[model samples]
Target: MRSNIPWLRTIEQFEDEAIASTAVRLAPMGRIDTDTLLSLHLGMTDQSVSTIASRADAIAELAALGSFDHAKLSKGAWRMFKDRIEFLGCVLPVGWLVPERRRLAPGQMASAGENARVKNTWLLSGLICDVETGETLLDRCPACLNLLAWRNLPNIWSCQVCKLDLRSVTPRQSPPEAVAAVRELARYLLKRDIRLPAPLGDLPSPDVLKFSAWLSYFRWLPEDLGLAISPKNVPAGFLLLKRWPTCFDEIVLKRMKASTAEDLAKGDVISRIKAAGTLSSSVARLPSAAAQAIVKSRLETLFGFLDGSSEGFQDVMVPISELVNSRF
Candidate 1:
């Protein structure tokens, strides 16, 4: 047994090395689409078919679990071939996520660098609209009521100084009016029992957009949840909500005996990958009734927590912590 020890050590070390290399490759790419990440794990680059990405996730789960205990029985005979798993399993993906998209991300600019304001401004879109008329509202600036930035003061359409409805003096833009309409909708939702985010788009950071767009459909909740969500992260919130109860399920973090883990191994890792595939960002292109329901549920739960009057959120900004990890 002692003589065979080196063999097991080498195999375990190789697996760790493989996964680490892949993590390094993935870490720098910023936000990577989960589908691409899984495809790389499965050892294909051409994207020859549209197989669900979770198959690869299953394989990766198998790989992650397999790493914990290297095969003592197979080590001596398959030492060399074992390296293939690490290379193919992990290294391949590292290469795949590294700047290989139709549109490359621009490098970050420091202060006084490239025009940061323009890039950020263009990065966002105004999606405000009136619920009753379904008309796109204008940018009703809260400061001067001249259609500028989004604000959270009472009486959304009122001019900050004069306390007069700006629309009475001058026509409000579609975006601002749309936001106001959404807030009113939020108020109505709280009056009832439904939960949702409101004001269309009032959040500061772009990350908030994902939740706003997701919860926008269920505006019967509270406006405090989604208004002013930043534009950049709207997509991620969508992605997370799409993968609920399993992607971040508390059970995913539970501890089990080694034997139980092994018992689950038959379907454990593979099932995870498949589950992940169901929500992989790539799923956005495909339509499924079941998928839509799951996504909708997640959006409901997330905004439900945010919209609850007890949360005491006064402004339109969503806290990064609650947006990401609120178990409720």
Candidate 2:
């Protein structure tokens, strides 16, 4: 059935967030979480919604039912949204990346790079500034330092707790190169076929790029080489190496291997058992052994990139192989 709500139009780059925000406004209590929003939009019970596997399924159901008009989305934009949701997970966890607050008039739609805040996506969570506007995404209320929670507020641009107009706060400065790196990553994620710069474009597939990006977050990798331990600096560091492919050389590989070796050396039988439990808990989504093997192979390919060797090269694989075998 077509949606009876007239203001339920999708915002271009902000489609998911817009839908989420609409769900919150429609809630009788003025606040609703992800599951409740899914149930409400899909006309399902909370229990039934819980059974749904992924956000892509919910979105597809919405599209098929004409809850969201297909004509409103540019063909390319709709395809990218569907592909990203199907391939990656949902938009990265809510509130992980600070968001820019923008006012949306009823039935209004806005595109990316407008003088408004950009929403987070699974691939773009580490962004600090809007690539187009160069505006620093706000993490908290400047007036009260309260963490921003979009769903909890009535007006997205106003801090519900402090009543501060977030837009009035001055934008913080970020490095231009850092902003460019994020823009590149976002573009790559959205349009995998888009020609990219050097080493990123050389990669075989978008999945390989994602696998390498995921490896950058593995806890055992050295802080300097991978993402910073500091939460705030992570976005700046997320694809810093990708922007400079030469940085992934033998020396960097040696450093990561040393770090992995040190971690393995610290573990005991009890620690190994604990690691096994941790792996089991974390990889529940990848339940099959074949799925785990695919991850292993992808990770090996990433190591190969670092050491300038073909996939599954023995010397580089030793450290990661030992770690994975020990944990599993």
Candidate 3:
């Protein structure tokens, strides 16, 4: 065991995996993935562990390996990584978007200051950008389109598969509004005192922001809406903006109504309710009665839009009504 171990202090904006991964590299552990390193050193079986206690234990164990048993880790090390949120595992070097005056040698990787540090919020929200520089974070290799998360490379600034220096690539221009949207989200994630803008602020809890991001980025909502600025064009985090709730609601309601109507038209009462049931399940975490009522009203109005028939409306609304009742 190396007594003079170069343990990198955790940057406040670095995600747990990023911190762990960089620590492994500085430990000269030779390219081991974060989970394997944790399992080998700490006997941790759960790769999804993100609790402060768990992270503190990991720091203590890692320090022990370096013969520093009494080393103290800061509480700030574990503050930003939330266990409830799933890992996006994406990273962007701090200066990736800014063009360098001098090009890198064929194999040289980019570094921000001394080392690359990814933003903590980007790991959660999958919004790739450093807001201050107005630069988008590159999560994919420009040469091969290989995802950054696909391989646990020793250097985060180089693509493992293609050996491409990410700093050498030209970046796409992110929209100003899109960057602003992501900036707001990152601010909210970092500081609890900072309230999210309107409509998003109307949400019951900040946890819902993750749900909304999922719906906007990964779910079928974008396709259904035929959004002018597709999720691909801008950061998916932009869809969580204060201006987007009405558009999101309209599309979701439209989708639910269309899906329900199609099933009802086939005279499948069970299928129609099943479709509505899925929607209800997705929004069950919404705690506001007013929000629930709005969803219910929109769902109920689906009947009015469908051939002006009231029959079977109650049947379709059963799941939604139950959701509302349960929440209230």
Candidate 4:
């Protein structure tokens, strides 16, 4: 990689020292959302649609059922590998590097210059079990990184691990009021543009508070996905995010819906979820519909501010462009 991009180089020094340290300490593990993991095995890792998008298509097409070492790379991708490395600041690693038990993001890896510290596919597989109703889907396990399965486990009742006795059970945990609150909060967050009025610490029941968190979770996806999964006024052709096969199980939903001792307000949901109160602790630990809400809120703010500033600058520049053109 070129070492002459002044802004890029300067920003590296400006990055938080602790963040870099934490990044280095965990870069080996790479970025795996632990909250999204369920069960896993060892094989050729990196199989998500996201990965496919990130990789050039020829590479993806040539990928056979068991081809690993010598990847079929088109000339374009090979050259891109060079250009990518220049931009990416690292070599394209050729083998399975055992993953260290650390969690770091791709951005962090770029900043820290630490490639796979170890080799472990943070993946899941098999029927995506509904966390609440035990409904199995042709989905992957949220805990482990693996491709989802549907046909093999038609009536499998027991968990692959810990023999937790996951099977057909009466699904009676959803509360009507709780669902309403969850749906409203989700809709609000899905389109949250301006700062929301501070939650007036006046919500009812702990269940209601959880519904708030679920709202936050639904907003984390891209806008289209957000619309599809939004609770209130979901678009005409969109399905609720709860039906999403990529990133949910009834278990997580149940936890989001489960009520606590007191119904906290909106702000409380953020503080409590971040602080992780007892009931909050269980549901807030990982990516829930709620945690996603928080992330969405933050990103929306960040992007909103950025987009606004960009628009304003462009508006200001319009007259200058016109004046310059007049001289010409």
Residue-level lDDT for 277 in candidate 3: 55
Candidate 2 or 1, higher lDDT = 2
> Mind giving the per-residue lDDT tens digits that candidate 1 earns over 7-124?
1211222321223222223322324333343344444344321121123433343234234332321121101122121111221111111111111011211221322111111111
**Which residue ranges in model 3 land beyond 4 Å of their true spot?**
1-17, 28-54, 63-83, 86-113, 150-152, 194-207, 214-294, 297-328
Q: Judging by TM-score against the true structure, name the best candidate.
A: 3
Residue 43 CA error for candidate 1 (Å)? 69
TM-score of each model, paired residue for residue: 0.19, 0.46, 0.51, 0.20
- Candidate 4 error regions (>4 Å): 1-158, 163-165, 190-195, 198-328
Instruction: Give the Å shift of residue 308 in candidate 3.
Output: 17
Per candidate, the number of residue pairs that clash is 27, 0, 1, 35
Error of 2 at 269 (Å): 30
- Give the winner by TM-score: 1 or 4: 4
Which of the predicted structures, 1 or 3, would earn the higher TM-score when compared with the native?
3
How far residue 231's Cα lies from its native spot in candidate 4, in Å, is 17
Off by over 4 Å in 2: 1-17, 22-123, 193-245, 250-328
lDDT values, one for every candidate: 0.29, 0.40, 0.45, 0.26
Question: Candidate 2: which pairs clash?
Answer: none
